[model samples]
Target: MACYRVVLIPVDENWTPASPDDVPPQPPQPNERLLETEDFFSAVREAIQFNQQTWSERKGRWAVVCEVGCPGKTWPGLRICTPLRYKIASIWWPPGWEPNSPLDMPLCICRTHGTLQEDQLSYEQALATIQALNQQAMDRASTMWYVMLAVENEPVSRTISYDPAGLQTTVEIRRLHVAQPAGGGHGDCSHCPARSLDCSMVAPA
Candidate 1:
């Protein structure tokens, strides 16, 4: 089986006013990046197929697990899942009535059914969970989360139909390194950028 490293970018919820007249800011959307180790495509395809089969008959709540590390020390990451329940109400129909019309039936059903189970935690909570998992992985193996980008290949001419040259695939990944916070403080910048006025600068006058 191939190996792949997935990195998910947490959505930023904290918003500040861009201008006095502007409306309150909204949270940014979460971005997901997947990195493959030489055989990412095959591994990801297998993972998805396995998950789909597991989800079909699995009862109660569901969680997605990602295996990390080699045989000596392997860790399984968890993500809580919740089933989607849709409720469609109409004024003309009775309460809790099902849509008989084919047009309305499609709309009544939620589209995001087979997707991964979603967590109730906020953006910050999700980020914290990911960070903790990454730290655990780092402690076990020297590997860190890396974002996968598009692949590049050499050009091939159509005139030479069976030519075996000029065909190459290059996978790009943005590596993220884990390091100790500056000053060993709480990672938050509460006292950063110290003002000179607060410093002991005696006036010449």
Candidate 2:
């Protein structure tokens, strides 16, 4: 089962009600909740392994693991396998691809369905669900493209990097570009292809 603990550090400035010492108590700072239970680690490990196997079978390639975190951050105390330690990986996939293709495979359990509540599913159950979803996708597709697997303490701090060989497994990751469609009717001049068509199309005098 997954267990999490949120630590609160008092911030002097933000704490209301001045203390007897004539100083305001600080607001509580949030610390990363540590995963302390052995069962929790086991579940996480199982999930990772299940995801890895699912990706490999569906994509025909193993996911790549990447090291993350600052030098001194306490090892979140997860009890996963050694090889998977400190290495967050991903299964890359192309966009708009067929099912079973790497492109259509689910990246991770956490990603497929947002982070779990404090203690929703045991790590094993989460992994199992992820594997089941991935297999379902693979069973439907003939050739998949790419999939990415990543691990990080917080989603914001997570980043995608290339391997030592300077080779990238994913064509593009975490980067998005969008273009507006052309205007069809009048008045939307900014997107009009033809410059002659002004706001009021009543032929210029």
Off by over 4 Å in 2: 1-69, 73-95, 101-113, 116-126, 135-205
- Which candidate should be chosen as best, given lDDT against the real structure? 2
Give each model a TM-score: 0.17, 0.20
Question: What lDDT score belongs to each candidate, Candidate 1 first?
Answer: 0.25, 0.27
Candidate 2, poorest ten consecutive residues by summed lDDT: 175-184
Give the Cα error of residue 64 in candidate 1, in Å.
5.6
TM-score, structure 1 vs. true: 0.17
Give residue 57's error in model 1 in angstroms.
Answer: 3.6
